[model samples]
Target: MTEAITVMALRQGVYDHFREEGDVFEIRKEDDFSAFWMVKVSDAEALALQKAAQRQPEASRHVVDTTVIDNSELEGLRIQLAEKNAEIERLTRNVPGKQADAPEKSAADVLKMANDPTVEFMTFKAAARKVLGDATPSTKAEIIAALEDKATAP
Candidate 1:
């Protein structure tokens, strides 16, 4: 059951609280109460809401231990970084060109490659794999020279 009360004096301040906390939800549609707005609320709910309306909202913020949280979060990040590095190593273990055992031609030999026009240098391909993957490592010597130039660059 529901009832209408002028409570006009109290209505102004409590309307917002009632709407948020309880079911004083919508204003009535009937053509009446010209001076003040009519909010429809259950008598039981209105009583509780009215009491809540009188009290001020609690002023407080949640307390957190930032040092503890930050340390834990950083530990988690470190673990993830280690896992990612391990995964990268695992994935790249068989990726053709990264073998440490592959033979490396000397700087002098690679440098003399400038004289060999048949030496083909692939832009992105590694010297070792280019020999096996393609017909031959025609330009690796030139690429090695370029690499050495960049390495000794000022």
Candidate 2:
């Protein structure tokens, strides 16, 4: 039987970077436990990548050990990982609830506000004030034209 191996790291980015480097792997992000990458990598390659990742400050705390286990042994480990992730999600959800009463702004609303002509004009006027200060007629006309073009563009 092909041996199953699992390794954990501090950040998903490290795993993603390694995967992108042509490594054959399956990665899963867990909210409770550290994120992991599972693969059939040669022991040398795994150790090398683990050490390299550990050199970075953010990934230094990662536990970069691999286990050799039967395929059947993974089912229970997967289930437990799922349960732990669910619990982590639940706890994280509660944290944001405390701040929910604060005013919330959607991305669309912010974009619309930014695109408002009055707001755009104010921004342009402020920038022009800094660059052109007491603007000449030519500079004023240029600013107006630029602002109009920005306002009209999709």
Candidate 3:
């Protein structure tokens, strides 16, 4: 049978003693008094085991080591990022040229409009529509250039 030690009252000294000695034992705290007795074990291994048992229990159900990162995994992540960037560019190219005035009222435009209070947000869209008219090849290029200009501007 496994030897047991009941610790009725816990003191810092007792905890330190167990930790320093590497003694292992089962501990039970006394409900009535502040004193706790260390579960007595005779054998050398048993004593060590009991001391280990007295140490804090593992709180986490699952443990993960975050220091390890494999080269293949990093390469896979890089490929995924590149693919996402490419897909974004492709989709941006595919956006219908008919709604060319939509971006004119975005956050950048709002900020620009603040600078020039005379330029209404609605009027910006109206001006873009008048300039572009129907969706032509030149209009598509113009819209793309305008988007690039807005993106690159301060």
Candidate 4:
């Protein structure tokens, strides 16, 4: 007589019994316990059950509605995305230190920038360098003197 076993029991020792030719296992899920299945079957019955299970999913697939967006809706979404991108760009432009071009500073403005603690030394040096030609002044006093000389020049 054949003994019916649970799916979990197959892993314990029941798997060794299926080595003979035409051996198969039928999984009958218990009505009360959805996760529990009783295993026992013929090779032909198991193959037929597997084929039917494959066909069931394919049949149910055709019943679901496929989502599709119309051209007008797609265009509207694209326009909204573009507007959001432009708004992001506008906001980022106003963020401190993101300026594309610094407004040209007067000699007095350069002096003020040199004196300001927050201003970077390299940035001040670049501005002063531009004004002083080949002279790359290192110290604040040197930069101020160079700018003063350039301001008084004809």
Candidate 5:
């Protein structure tokens, strides 16, 4: 059963009943610009009313579908990233301005390159290997003699 009560006509007992029985009946306030009525509804009636409200055109206008995925932009970005990486590798191949086919350095040139402060350590090691047949030299004089021998050799 359902009943309608006005805010002006509501008694304390109605408030007490609703407080003690938590939402056993759904109450909705209806107003037509003049008077308001508190209408009590059953559970089934409340569910039906809610479903009807969701089916209204005004409710559908608030929802948007945004589930579309575009992979072309992502693929284009990946291609551009790969091209940039390749360009970096190509530019760095001759980074020290040395060519792969440069002629082998003579003993005097090797000694000069080894003693130069601005040369990289790898060049010093290469010179040592060329003169001493090993990457390390025990004494500075031994390396110097070895370089002089190679310089005088045919």
Candidate 6:
């Protein structure tokens, strides 16, 4: 069997995609500030992980380390991580809610999002605020025009 590897310091966007795919991954660490994660995988899966990481828009390259553990140990680790995650969520459930973060987007990015045929008013408004730091125009055409203007600005 191929050796297992641990890929460290992954960006949050990348981790979000991986978190849903339960097979072939075990998250070992997470940092909220930089949104970095550490995950365990087989060397056999490392190439696929690298390709997936490469697809992430704003992530840096990750360093891989050898991970030595028997199957039982790996399972134990996953169970522990999941329990910790559940407990963390439970403890924080009563805290005041904050707005969900919009990914770091530029005017051009918001313009591209605005161009989506299915873009909703509230979605565009939130994206516009993130990109433009102000209220978005009320109408789609106006938002598109404003985004275009920003995209073309010096």
Scored by TM-score, the top model is 4
Q: What's the lDDT for candidate 4?
A: 0.61
After best superposition, candidate 4 residue 126: deviation in angstroms?
Answer: 3.4
**How well does model 5 score by local distance difference test?**
0.56
lDDT of 6: 0.61
Itemize residue pairs with steric clashes in candidate 1: 119-138, 119-139, 120-138, 120-139, 121-139
- Lowest-scoring 10 consecutive residues by lDDT in candidate 3? 4-13
lDDT of 5 by residue, 105-142 (tens): 67888778756889876766665675557545656566
lDDT of 3 by residue, 1-154 (tens): 4333433223223543433233343444333222343334446657566565557454321144434668898899999999999998877875644465465444354334334668654555444444444541234345545644554768
Clashing pairs in 6: none
Candidate 5 structure, TM-score to reference: 0.40
* Each candidate structure's count of clashing pairs: 5, 0, 21, 0, 0, 0
Better of 2 and 3 by lDDT: 2
- lDDT tens digits, residue span 11-97, model 6: 433544643222234344433223234444566676686677668643233333225457898899899999999999888766522
Tell me the spans in candidate 5 whose CA falls farther than 4 Å from its real position: 1-71, 96-99, 120-122, 130-132
What lDDT does the true structure give each of the candidates?
0.50, 0.49, 0.48, 0.61, 0.56, 0.61
Residue 14, model 5: lDDT of: 49
Q: Give the TM-score of candidate 6.
A: 0.34
Against the true structure, candidate 1 reaches a TM-score of 0.26
Tens digits of per-residue lDDT, candidate 1, 26-98, equal: 3343343333444445567667776775674433111344444677788998999999999999999887557
Estimate TM-scores for all models.
0.26, 0.22, 0.25, 0.42, 0.40, 0.34
Cα-based lDDT at residue 86, candidate 4: 99
Tens digits of lDDT, candidate 2, 31-109: 3223343334566777677677567565333354235556777888999999999998788776632555556433233
10 residues in a row with least lDDT, candidate 2: 29-38
